[model samples]
Target chain A: MRDLLRILSRFWRASLAAELEYRVNFVFSTLNAALGLVLGLFALSLFFQNGHAFDGWSFDASLVVYGLFTTFSGISSVLFVPNLSRVVEHVDKGTMDFVLLKPVDSQLFVSTRNFSPWGLPDIALGLGVIGYAARRLDVDPGHVPAALLAALLSLIILYSLWFALASTSIWFVKVYNATEVLRGLLDAGRLPIAAYPAGYRVFFTYVVPVAFLTSVPADVLRGADATSWLAIEVVVAVLAFGLSRAFWRLSLRSYTSASS
Target chain B: MTFLRRARAFLEVYYAYMLVYRSELLLWALAMSLPFISMGAWIKAADTGAFPLAPVEFGRYFLVVYLVRQLTVVWVVWEFEYDIVQGRLSPRLLQPADPVWHYVGGHVAERAARLPFTVVIVAFFFMLYPEAWFVPSWTETVACLALSLLAWVLRFVLQYAFAMAAFWTEKASSIEGLWQIGFLFLSGVVAPLAVFPEAVREVVLYTPFPYLIDVPVRALLGAPITLRDVLIPGAWLLVALVAQRLAWRAGLARYSSMGA
Candidate 1:
């Protein structure tokens, strides 16, 4: 664990240095993030224009969900997506051998090898939205712990889901489109799961579990009784992580060293 | 070779290239259907009389938006950004053909390759909501198809122009990202323009954004097609083509001066 921490720190430093070389990226990403938040707010206002509530979600409540979705998007883009996209490139170019030969866990190294510091603006913007929404809703301080716990579990589930998808590149070598599929699912997370039909809600909650990534956390923040949902999220996260790790091992076993 | 023969060869090459990435094309078609996400919320809101659109109308509108989006979406910004940053445009410049056609050809071919998948998805939606499906009059159908082609051309030129910023900065993709936020809301991807606040709708109707997706969708949904609808998009297409030409010339000059 100590070695892994050191490696991650070193990798992060390198990534930060590389990213800082292009300072304009920070400005552009900040602008893009702000524009995205504005659009989200616009969409929310449009939805609430005719009524006070949508499918039992007040405007402020839906904003909370949108905030959670934005935060998740930031986290994924900053950490998971950049790294997983590399997995596809490495597999395609037979550079996976170098990754495996590294003096650390291959999965760990591969998953944490890079980061996009520009994505920080997205995180900041998302937190700002969440704060504004929470204030508007007058969320109770008592709900903070559950909300934090649900948010953590949601992150875990999302990372596991991305890892599983990235691992498929070892066999398919061109499953990069998996991220696009995930993006589509994440777009759905901008609204409460209950807003969808019964069939879509079932598919999102159990099959893809995008509902758990944002809606459950938002529900907890709204002081809703989401304890059971949080429990399910935790269970799903653990199972997904274990299954993905096993799949990674199986994929690695089939990976022939390209250098040879 | 003559221009038509060269164009034919480019189309064939890109068509085969697209076929090789059929899975990615299918995934892209699926991803572009994100209108469904907002459709769910609007439908639910309509059910409670919170929105003006009937639930069935929301279904039909979003379904048409989904299909039109798949048909018209352009990804040239990413491609041009890559070529500029990696100096790949130098080789293409040496060829007899203009590189813009390479991107245009690839996009058109990819859309053709995605036809089967688009049909499958549309059929599935039709199966699920047979009552929501509507076939427009022959004139409306023909006009919608023509408008969609114009929309695609305008989008392609606009994105290619935007991507030319890569010659000046490494963050060109950020411009595309920012444009997408505006396109998402103003183009009626989130909801029909008719449902927007009357003042906002009036303003949006004058912009090029609505011509990109909303006009074609409205026409396909049996809304009255107007001469103004065709004229506005035609004007925008001419503007985009001029901008694209100017940007391309400036970008090539920069590329040459920089010895790249």
Candidate 2:
């Protein structure tokens, strides 16, 4: 564990130093994220026009969901996208041989290899929005930890799904767009599950599992009695993580490297 | 080579190349599924409350939005930057014809490949929710298709202009990211322009963004539209064409190959 931590820090620092060489990207990403937040707010406001709402979700409540989605988008760019995209490149180039040759677990190394600080602005903005929404809702301080726990579970579910998609590259070598489709579908989480129609509610909840990623966490954040939902989120996260692990192992078994 | 012959060769070769990536293209088509998800929310809102567009109309509108989005999508900035950064632009530059035509050919061919996938998804979606289906007059269909093509051209030229930044910076694609935020929100990708506040919609219509997605969607859905809808985007296209021309000349003047 300590060795992994050292390795993680080392990789992050190296990438950070290299990325700093192009400081202009930081400015561009900040601007991009800020503009994106404005657009999201505008879209949310459209749903609330004339005292209407997304199903029963007030604008403020949905903002919490949007905030979580933004926060996770930043986390995705920082962790999931950078690493998982490299997974495809490495597999395509028959470079997975080198990854397996390393002393550490290949999955760990592939999953935690690089960090992009560009998502920092998005992360900060998301937290700011979340705080603002929570204040508006007058959320109880005691339930904040419950929200955090649900969000942590949400992260686990999200990472597992992304990793599983990336791992398919070992067999298909071009599943990059599969992950793109996943990210696109996950955009549904920007609103509460209840906002969608019955069929779509089932599709997102079971097929894509988007509900646990944002809506459930938002519900918890606003102090809704959502313990049952949180429990379901816990189970879903665990199953997703385990399934991803098994899938990666199976995929690796089929991976025939050109290098060796 | 003559102009007609050169265009023929580009399209044929690139079409074959795109056909080879058929499955990849399918995944890319699926990556734009956000409209379907949003359609569910809009339909729900229309069902549960008073809204500008009816429930069936919201369904029809968002489906058309998805179709227009697929038809008008552009990724020239990323491809152009790659050519510049990797110095692959040299051989194309050495050719008698301009290199921009190469990227344009690829985009057109990719769009051709995407058409079948788009049709399949639309067919399947209508199968599941037949209530969203609508039939429009031939004139409206033709006009919508024309505007969709025009939107594609305008977006391509604008992005190609931004792609010129690769001459000075390695991260030209970041500009695409920023541009997409505006494209997603202002272009009515999130919801129909009818749902937007009248004043905001009026202001947004003045911009090129809504002309790209909303205008075509409205036209296809048999909503009231004037020649002004077509005129605004046509004017923007001319402006973008000039900008693209200036940027290409400047970028070519400053261009240096990777190992040069």
Candidate 3:
């Protein structure tokens, strides 16, 4: 694990150096991300127009979910997109064979070999929003650990879903854009899970598991008892990660390289 | 006669290619299901809140939103960026027709291929949420189709205009992504404009974003629309056309596509 961390750091540093050459792009990306966040918040505000709130959710509490969604989107951009987009290219060009022959774990190497600072603004803004909400709500600092734990579990579930879908590219190169479907669905996370109807609730929780990514974490942050959903979330994170790993290995078995 | 024949040729070849890529197109169609997801939230809101529209009306609004998105979605910027980066544009530039025609042809063809998938998804959605079922009058149907066509053209022109940024920056799609942020909020995808505050709705009407997604949606919902609604997007279409012309001239002068 230490060696993996060392190699991952080296890879990220190399890409970061390359990306830093575009200072103007970084600035534009930051401005764009900020604008996006503002507009997103504005969209959320619309639902709260006339002081109406979803059942059991105030606008302030919804902001926590919005923040988590934005943060996870940032995490996706930083890691999932940069890597998964390349997985298509690597497989398309038969470079995956070369990657597989390497000494280290191919999945870890591919997943972390590139880092994008473009999503940095999004992460910062998301954290800023989360902090802003915590301040406004005046929550006791005692709940901080619960929030952190929920955040970590949600992130794992998200990354696992992304990797699991992206790994299918080994057998179906055209499935790269399948993530776009996942992304469109993830927009549901921008709202509180309670805002959705019963059918949507069931689908979002069991089918896509979007609730675990946003609402569960936000629920914990809002001083709610985690007892109702925490165990399920833990099971989901473990099951999702395990599924992604098994799927990747299963896909690799079917991969046929052009260069070979 | 020659122009008609050439256009047909382009469309035919692209149509064949799109048929081969029908599976990929299915995923792309599924990606536009954000409206359905948002519909669930809005419909749920109507059940509890005192809002402008009823639950069934909100369902129809977002169902139409899904259709508008499917009909008007554009990816020319991504294709153009890839062509520029890979120097594939050079060979296309050597062709008699402008490269934009090829992209336009592909988009039109892909829409044809994607229609069945869109139908399937909507059918499934209706099965699940039968409250959303409704049929517009013939006049509304005809007017909505015409408005949707205009929306598609406006979006395509706008995206193609942004694609010119690839000559100046290799990643023009990210620039186009900024436009999506605007679209996500102002285009009435998240909520119907009727739900917005009177002041905000008045202001948002003037932006080009609403014409791309909202006008056609409202038209299909049998909402009262004036001649100005059509005129505004028509004006933006003219503006984008001229802008794209200028951008094409300037960008071509700067373009250095691999030994050109």
Best model per TM-score: 2
What global local distance difference test value does model 3 have?
0.87
lDDT of 1 at B220: 81
Task: Locate the minimum summed-lDDT window of 10 residues in model 2 chain B.
Answer: B251-260
lDDT top scorer: 2
> Which sections of candidate 2 miss by over 4 Å?
B258-260
Q: What is the Cα-based lDDT of residue B22 in candidate 1?
A: 86
On residues B1-260, what C-alpha lDDT tens digit does candidate 2 reach at each position?
58889899999999999999999998899899888888888888888777988888888888899899888888889888888888899888878988889989999888888999899988998998898777889988988998899889899988988898888899989888888899888888888887888888888888999988888888887777788887888888888889888887887888878643
CA error at residue A110 for candidate 2, angstroms: 0.6
Cα-based RMSD of the predictions, in order? 1.9, 1.4, 1.5
Each model's iRMS: 1.6, 0.9, 1.2
Runs in model 3 deviating more than 4 A are none
How is the predicted docking of candidate 1 categorized under the CAPRI scheme? medium
Q: Residue B241 in candidate 3 has what lDDT?
A: 92
**For model 2, what is the alpha-carbon lDDT of residue A209?**
97
Write down the C-alpha DockQ for each prediction. 0.68, 0.84, 0.75
TM-score of 1: 0.95
The model with the greater lDDT, 2 or 3, is 2
lDDT of 1 by residue, B45-100 (tens): 78876666789999988998898888897888899888877778888888877888
Candidate 3 structure quality by residue, lDDT tens digits, A23-94: 777877887889999988888887887668988888888988898888889888888888888888898888
